[model samples]
Target: MQIFARITSPATQSLTTYRPTPSTISFTVSTRPVPRTLPARLLFYLSILVRIILGILALALLWAKWRITFPIEGDISKGVRAELTTWVLGSSAGQAATRISTRLQWRLLIPGALGVLWGVCRRGYTEESLLVLSGLGIQTSTSSPTYLSTATTRFIPTTSIQDIFIHEAFKGFEVRFYLAIVVQGEEDVVVVFPNLLPRRRILEEVWRGARACLHELQPKSKF
Candidate 1:
């Protein structure tokens, strides 16, 4: 009975008695989807279009104002004086004053209008925007040799020679040649020119005058 039971039992079966072959399995892998690149291209083109439009407008406005002078005659000094006179006179001045007033108004209006248009158009381009922002409110003046010479001579009498030397040497070309003396304080004087160049002779003369003044103030000191 035990032998019959063993013969029927699965555990008692030998390795050679019966065997089943293993089956191989196959798998299918899905490929990943490619990313779309159209958005990036669209952004690049938009940026380029903004830059071109801004550049063209800025150039056109600049060209229009290139040879055109403020105050019509390029006489800023006279225009300023005339404008101030008109303001002071109120209604007393006659036809000449009226014509001058009209001209000044146009001079101011034309440049101001052009500037506004340029600013609006320039906002579109990144490079032009950067440049315009960087130079906002900055102005440049080119002084003739006569102006520099006259300024140096005129400044000496008003300022202490010592102060002038120290101011010129320490501050250099930054002192406003025209209105250095008229400025009330040290800081104002420093800020006025901020980019002026004094001649060597002028520098030496200022130094000598300052030293003499110092000697007069302190006779005991050799300086």
Candidate 2:
């Protein structure tokens, strides 16, 4: 990964306390991007009985969809089919129910519901990243655990950036260092890597690199 953005200046490096102030910080901070793929270790919250009920309902739906003659039909089996068949009447009603069940069955709902449940139970990030483009704006992104959801993002144009600073704040009982951006026309500063607020040294690295790339520095970027 590109950790720093310093220009080679023979005189600049040798001279102490000179124009560049040691370095400029440009921040395209990072945390690994979360993969949308289902994790190898996943937890399911449904009780065994509830899951069995769902499975029976699924089997029943398959029976209806393909017109299988069932050996047994119970609350666990006919649960969904019986409910939908309630809407209309006749021998053809079963056919209608079968048609509707094809669309509403567990084939689609299980995966979707499981995805939502996974997101709720596993409250953590998969990926978080920041990107800085010279003379352009910067972009920050956060990846969600579930592929069903989109990544959250924001972009701040270069012209709207007032300053980038490192701030110390108390999270719980301890102080933490975080990189923040001063955006034009915004009262509250934008925080970088808010979730993964790394250590001071890391922030310092990003802070210097971000500034170096975005602004002209001491010794003034000589040719």
Candidate 3:
């Protein structure tokens, strides 16, 4: 009976022996996110190209102005005559000079006129005031007949005098004169006197005062 029991136990132990099992997990692959680039690089390059083209055009214009030379021939007097004839006939030199002068005049006159207009318009007459500065001297309002009479008597006695130079600021002069006259209503007529002074010390003082006033009113610096 003991031998039979031992045989049965050995058979049970053999049935319970460990066996290896295959893993069920699969391997995972990680990928990184790709960075995107901006498209503004093309626009930047185009702007640079445009600026270079403009610079080249400007240089060409300057060269044309300087390189247009008239060749002299024959006697000195004859050569001068020939040169004058060529210039009158729109020679290269004449053309160059014309182009340069026209461009220069346009550049100078347009901005200058605009600046003058801006200054005049900016100083629109609202009330009577007096301004004294380094380059500009006493700018008095000429809105009233009494003020106009006083200014005329103090500066120009004759109405025929179109303009007068007044020494103002330290070493600057202002050209002062009547600009226009306006009739607002019955018994309400006003004369406008505009003063044109150098945009140096005299204008700077006024600008500073204006800036201060603006800051005080706005409580912030715009410039």
Candidate 4:
């Protein structure tokens, strides 16, 4: 990882307000990044299934209404036009369907977001060392930032860091997702977060913190 850009003093000052402790840095990340273990992978896919089911149900409701409002005969009579208009844009059922779709989307966001937040709070970072990691997903304004679980904190000496790589690629929709942090002897830690900020900027900040520790260990970095 490289700190391509230096953070401005004013911007740094503003961010310091959130760092309650000295020499501490924090960021939100996902709790589970597409599990590698069999059991975890199964659970991850099961969650996807639940979301798919919800989406299918929403589409099915809309399709049912569409079929009822406009039969295959393709009638264009004045009464038929009125009924179609009511069912699609003006009827109570139409309104109900719209609300249901919105509600289901919100339901998916809740668990998906909360699970990551809970993980971060419990494992975001360890206090004893320079590296800190918590929950699973990127942090949210609604989450409690400092409520970290000490047990999950592991201190990897700055010298042990061989290379820091942040891999970014688009999953879809102009939103490039997935960030992976590959450590020397451990499994790669990959995270999936919303692309609110550019990925490079986030990586820069993370590298800045990690570098701070590494620089103290070795004034001249090897890589």
Candidate 5:
């Protein structure tokens, strides 16, 4: 079985070592990934395309000659905080011009809203958790151990581990992977990493490490 001896933890910003019962296999799962595969590269390009479309729509609004007023501006620690207030002035052509102005505002706002939503959803993909396998059972924790009450920290016996697999899936705008540890009579435990390391290598290494750990434990043996 393939084993990664030293793996870096993106959450705690430290190296993590796993030596379960003398037979040790470990690897780090970081965010940055190398996508060389066809489908992986395709997804990466698709995400870029989405971002470009959003940017074009934003530029179109700016080019419409809307009156912009900065109603709020202040000094902060290193920069100034400001708000851009934009509006369209009705032309002298009467009610028809007024209607057009209102319509333009709605048109700009609709695409703007979609862009914001897309960005928010994309950023939500970064969440952190760690998994440790040992002789007696599997231990999981958030990097912040003191926040155990609010985090996922637990020990599941080897027998209780129902399904174990590495999920190489796209989360939002990123193509990240996670160790999906499903336990019997319990919800699955997913150890996800932030986007801070090589993507494909981490996926392959983590999958190999997790599989090695599971192989040693022999938890009903699911791929």
Candidate 6:
């Protein structure tokens, strides 16, 4: 991730970026990731995909869990099972696998499904973003944990937005700064970067940039 301008706190260990354009201002914070190359990113996702596929295969195997001799004639069932098991799993390993599957039943499938779920919850880089569009509106979005899920987003039109400002609140024991947008009709204010909750300096920079972009105003002369 490229950080154009930011204020990092060793205590929080957050990565923040601010980008302003002629008509928009955007700010984002990421709590994960160490900056990867193109190939590395591809490989990272590929690894996660491979793990999910493996978990799926584990569950699929239960569906085709080698019926063996469950419905065959009593006397010849063993012989037929031995032949079929050997044909598929090859000699000793085949018979052993069938026995384990028969004994475990759903015990095996549950683990595989849980493994897949765990993979789905492992979000490599968690990011939260705030986007302000000059005459349009403002939006807040949180990146999804896994590739299977979509980002969570909310958009408030410019008309509904009453004001945007920073406020202080007790997060744990220390007071942290957060940006909030007051909506015209809503009882609760919408908080930006809810998860990341960057420092005040970063929030102030974003506040200024957002106002300048949304109002089409240039900074006053310092002199």
User: What C-alpha lDDT do the candidate models reach, one value each?
Assistant: 0.34, 0.60, 0.35, 0.45, 0.50, 0.72
**Candidate 3's residue-wise lDDT over 94-159, tens digit each?**
575447645664466445544543443342222233332222222334332322233321211122
Pairs that collide in candidate 6 are none
Counted clashes in each candidate structure: 8, 18, 3, 18, 7, 0
Relative to the true structure, candidate 1 reaches a TM of: 0.19
- Give the number of the best model, judged by lDDT: 6
72-122: candidate 6 lDDT, tens digit per residue: 466675796656644765546555556656666566656765676676567
Model 1: per-residue lDDT, tens digit, 1-223?
A: 9999867743211111111211111111111122258887787677658756655544433433432333334465468766664454354433333434445545664575566555544322110000000111111122223211221112222233223233333444444222122233445442222222333443344334333432443336566
| TM-score winner | 6
Q: Lowest summed lDDT over 10 consecutive residues: which window, candidate 3?
A: 10-19
Write one digit per residue (lDDT tens) for candidate 5, span 35-150.
78999999988987886666654544443323332233346323432222222222333333334434666666657655654563453222343454544456554433222125
Tell me the TM-score of each prediction against the true structure. Answer: 0.19, 0.48, 0.19, 0.29, 0.36, 0.64
Comparing 4 and 5 by lDDT, which wins?
A: 5
- Candidate 2's TM-score reads 0.48
In order of TM-score, best first, we have 6, 2, 5, 4, 3, 1
Which candidate would rank higher by lDDT, 1 or 2? 2
lDDT (0-100) at residue 180 of candidate 3? 26
In model 2, which regions exceed 4 Å deviation? 1-124, 216-223
Ranking by lDDT: 6, 2, 5, 4, 3, 1
State model 4's lDDT: 0.45
Candidate 1: stretches off by over 4 Å: 1-194, 221-223
